[model samples]
Target: MTSLVTDTRVVFSRELRPVLRDPFTVIFSMIQPLFFLGLFAPLLPDSPDGGSPLQWFVPGIIVMSCLFGSSMTGSNLLYEMQTGSHERMLVTPLRRPALLIGRALKEIVPMIAQAALIVAVCIPFGFELHLAGALLGLVILAGFCIGLGALSYTLALASKNKEWMFWTVQQTLLFPLLLLAGVLLPIENGPGWLQALSRINPMTYVVDAERALFNGEVLARGTLEGLVAAVLVGLLGLAAGVRAMRRSD
Candidate 1:
């Protein structure tokens, strides 16, 4: 057990070094969320419930940041695969599960940092959140990130061509999930079919939970549902990712 933990940490450090060296990648990842926060949030009409626009919008932006950032992780894996870096790692003494765990765990660091930055920026704009709620939201986001990052890596490993993975992620998966999650606008106000579809999306629960948390409603039904969804996603993603790694071996 100790060896597995140590190997996972070592693999995590190896994957994280390149990201640390290229700080711009982190900045670039945050830009889209910032754009929505700065430009789009202001244009939103006042909430019917009397909350500030930032309060209503910031949670969605945080979820957006997590989704976009983590879902794109597969592209990095594709690069490693093409360059033979992933294959080289396979020759090491590292366990297959550790390879996926380490990479997936590393995703939590940047995601948490990004979530913190988003909240800080929104604070000056009148976003209100309890520290306890904020911490809970971060925990939820961590689970979501681990799951999405693992799934991304698994998809990358399954694809024979990098372009296929890129196309599928961007064109097929990302936008549909984003739209269904109601990141840009509330689905409740949409037509009946759209609302129905949103109900089935796991991300819908997550975004709703985030909004409840941001409003300091820690015990809200949405918050509980989101936590459950996040755990399920994390388990399923880790399972699939580990299976993919074993197949590669």
Candidate 2:
């Protein structure tokens, strides 16, 4: 058990070094989300819950950051595989699961930093900051990011040869997942089919939880649902990631 922790820490720091050197890599990733906040946000009517659009939109953007930031982590692993760097690591004595877990864990720091930056940017524009609830919300986002990151690594391993396959599936699924989760626009009044799909989309629960927490409603029912969904995703991702790591070339 101690060895796993040590191995994971070693791997985590190795993956994180490049990001530390090039901080803007994280900031550049936020460009799209910020654009959505700047342009798309003002077009929406105030939320029915009596909150301003920024209040409603900012939380979703945070989730969007977590989604995009964590999901693309697979590309890094794929590049490493192509360059033989991944094989070098495979020859090390580190436990297989540690590789996946550490890579996934590395996503959390940037995810939280990006979330904080978004909140700071939005607050000046009248986005309310519910400190306690927002802190809790970050916890949920971190868990979700870890799970998503692991799954991304798994996908990269599965597509080590055909890099396009990773991008193809990612591009195909992300928008549907984003739209269906009501990140940019609410789907409450959308068609029955859309609503049905949203109901089953796990990310939808996380979005709902983010909104509720940002509103200072930490005890809201959506919080429980999102926590559950995030945990399940994390467990499933780690499980799959470890399995994939064990089988990697």
Candidate 3:
């Protein structure tokens, strides 16, 4: 058991080092979301019934960071696959599941850092909230991102396609969730059907919860729901990825 944990940590450290080394990725990951928040959040129509676009969009921008992280999940594995490193690793006595889990876990660092920067940028724009809740929101969003990234990695491995599919699917699936999460528009203000759909979207729960946190609205319910959804997504993604790897072996 200790060995498994150690292996997971080793793999996580190996994956995290590259992120730290890549100054460009770090710069863009942390700054781009803030840039979006400043430029696009204001252009959104003023909301009388709902909160400002900054309020609505901040959570989605945070989620957007996660979505982008998901695109890279497969890239590393694909590169290793092409270079024969992945095949060699498969022959080791180390637990393969730990390797995958560790890789996914390490990605949360940058993902959360990116989200934190977005939250920090939001403060100047009048987006305020309890520090405790904001911290909780960041943790929750990071978990969701980690899970989603794992799922995307599994998909990439399964698809065995080019790099474009990773970006394409990440954008296609995650962007719409952000849109529905009341990012550009108020989920409550939408049509009944659309509101219902948003309610079903896991991303919506995170947005709703964060919005409440920002406005000092109680958001225990949304937070719980979002947490559950993120956990499920992560578990399913990890399971699939492990299964695919097993098949390859």
TM-score of each: 0.94, 0.97, 0.85
Candidate 3 runs further than 4 Å off? 29-32, 45-53, 161-164, 215-219
- Candidate 2 matches the true fold with a TM-score of 0.97
Q: RMSD in angstroms, candidate 3?
A: 2.8
Cα lDDT tens digits, model 3, 116-143, are 6677767776775567776777777666
In candidate 1, position 237 carries an lDDT of 92
| 70-140 per-residue lDDT for model 2 (tens digits) | 98999999999999999999999989999999999999999988998998988887898989999899889
Residue pairs clashing, model 2? none
Instruction: Give me the candidate number with maximum lDDT.
Output: 2
Worst 10 residues of 2 by lDDT: 46-55
The lDDT-based order of candidates, best leading, equals 2, 1, 3
Residue-wise C-alpha lDDT for candidate 1, range 1-249, written one tens digit per residue? 468899899989988897888866776777888888888888899988877888878888998999888888877888888889889999988989999999998888888788888888778878886789878988998899899999988888887465675656555887788889998888978999999999888999999999889889999999999999898899899999999989984
Better of 1 and 3 by lDDT: 1
> How much does each candidate deviate from the true structure in C-alpha RMSD?
1.6, 1.3, 2.8
Model 3 TM-score is 0.85
